[model samples]
Target: MTSLPADDIASPTSTWDLVPATVLSTTETDGPDRPEPRPACEDVRPVIAGHRLIGACADGPRAAQLMFVSDAEGRLARAAEDGSVEPGCTLEELAGDLARSTGRQLHPENPGLRRVLLVRLDAPELPLLAALSGTGFTAVSRHGWSVVVFDGELDYWAVRTGLDETAVVLSSDGATRSFEVLLAGEDPADVTELDSADAVCVLEWGPPWQPAGGLPAGSGRTPAGQFEQDLVRLCAGGTSELQIESVASVFDLDPAETNRLRNYVGGGSTDLVLESVLQLVGLPVLAAKIAEGRREMADLEDARHYEPTAMGPALLRGMTTEPTGDGLMARYQRAVLRRPELLLALAGTEAALGLGLAGAARRGGSGARVLGTLSAALLADAAAESAYWATVRRARRGSARAVPAGLLRRFFGLPEG
Candidate 1:
């Protein structure tokens, strides 16, 4: 394995020489006409050279910056506002402008003014790929979220030989570390447990075909296979640690429980907060209770020793509307044991669920849709919480898991819903 300095990492395909670029801020700029610079919206799909730059930034110094044009409305908007379609600040021009303005060569304090990022959410838009990559903003994981370069510094663990390759990206305090493992030609099917460390891991198929997105084709997956795939993608590609931590904050989970849930979700557990809440409500016990009636419900609740709350009941009811993983409700009881707050967080479960659902909706909608339907199930759970547990109480033998996954679609919301 070779350690490479971020600045020294070469772009394998980009031929254009690195040039200076201007850095601008919407917030600091004095005029009302200024468009505030945000982390260049995560939409760019980069090629090899651009991908390398993104990886370098993620693994580079926390302060290392990449800049970009903050405009999203395109040349029409630019022309309309500035009376010209030509760029206000080209990359080279921006670099020089930034240097002169900040008086620190490039105003090391601000990174976005330097370039752009590779952050496509769906399939790659081949046409916009190069232009986006060329800007040099931070490259995103396959999931289309901004990859934050950590503050501390980076270390390399690249492997030259063939192995069941995996890349784990860890982030803390605006710092990130990546671990690239070569499994020495190990069977791709073989399970490779990630180190228990807290960092997010981005698994790469490595060597054979490093997908530009870093997520290999995951066609048909076994339960374990799916778990592994989810684990890697959730951590490496989708959502950042801070994003998940923010969701946890809505639940008022303590530092430890919040971290555990964040890492679990980062490791690819979907609907984690919701599912954990269901366990708190004793949804799975509905199946057994059907056979023994009220006696079993009492016994089961006693053993678990927890009072039902709005969260658990709501999640249970909402999930009952569709239920392939209904059996997994039993799994939550175990999780509560590991992290008691899994249930305790339910004290404010309704508020937490609402926040999570709203967060999902805020993520945006599909091409034709107006609302973000991706997380509609969470919304359904929130709306149906009042009725979910009552239905569970009336369930009979084998009835708990009876609902099909399809039923949940009614709540999935707009676009596809």
Candidate 2:
């Protein structure tokens, strides 16, 4: 690879206010023992599949996998032993391809997200560094990915020379591993096959790093799996660990909280759903308060059973109310509750599905048909709130009276308007 001027690489404009390191060794008396560089451990060899290097490694209790793609290689690899050439990829084309696989963790056979990656490229390191840095990666060393996985912390040299990307070790599905690249000082002339893993390539962003365009309006008629994919894509957009984890599994949430949100959503107002999800994932104290409030609401529901007249004042005020397991609300609320992080998107989806199911139930649609229709809707992009409320507007039945949005918001402690 031609050596690019170091100045070509973009650096952080400001220094991070890092936490002070605890000084030990000969610190106070003799200037701290020059910090030692951590050892490198490249314990695994990842398979080079097309343009991406996919592999897994473990260090004690921590484990991670790597899915590294190079744009130049994807487009230029030979087809067979006779060496028929394949079309090379443009920078944007390659970036989009990589993002689709990486964004949803559905490629290379559902590897899920990993803690680290081991990359080898022959091009200028600037572009790849930028992408990883923007995605919250910290370069721990020059020795390669293995050593950093074992130590879980970078040496002074790695920190000083590398971008100030913060590294967070999250719970991963594979072995604990570190990410290191095989570039920096290697010779391009010594490189053998361009398609081979040893061949180096530079990475640059494409016009679309991931899938493009806004989510479509959801309906029973949506193409199979589109809505579910939208939900998964929403999870990928999250920046915090809590946001990421919460979206990973809806079943991980508390049953009571899901139940409460279910009733409110059934009543045709998903206004507070986003705030509730944020609190559940990022602020436990607030979540506890919400839970406590829900408990009080539950108590009121119990009171309604014994003193229906006594609860009239509260009901007239449009408070958030709980519905029974078999109620119209539960039919979709429980389904959407499983993935609360998507509550915003799902609010409209659940409403649309509920409407279809309601008509189906009245028209004597079979259980299988009702459930199958709902299943399809769940996987498609949810409808907008306006769409959901429109359906509520057309409702003339007494049952719809229980779904007043203002009362529901008040009962759930949501702000007015």
Which candidate comes out best when scored by TM-score? 1
Q: Tens digits of per-residue lDDT for model 1 on 1-417?
A: 111122221212212121212122223345888644332112111221221111111211223323221222211001112122222333343335434544323332333211111111111111122122221111222221222121112111111121122222221112221121112353222332322222322211111111122112342132222322332342344445654554444346677776665555444222132234223322232221222122222333211111223333423333432211212332332243234343334424654665665675676655313333424544445445434334443442234311212232333221221
Clashes of 1: 30
Candidate 1 residue 104 Cα shift, in angstroms, is 1.8
For all predicted structures, in order, the TM-scores are 0.20, 0.15
lDDT of 2 by residue, 1-417 (tens): 211122211212111110100101111223376543221112222112343211111122122222221223333211222222223333344335544543311123213223232222111122233233332222222211111121122322332244333222221222111112223344222443323322322111101112111112232133212322332232222133332333323325566664543433233212243334334433222222222232222333222211112233323322212222333333333333233344455566666776666566566645857666764554342443333333334332233212333333333334532
lDDT measured at residue 178 in model 1 versus the true structure, 0 to 100: 19
RMSD to truth, every model: 27.4, 26.6
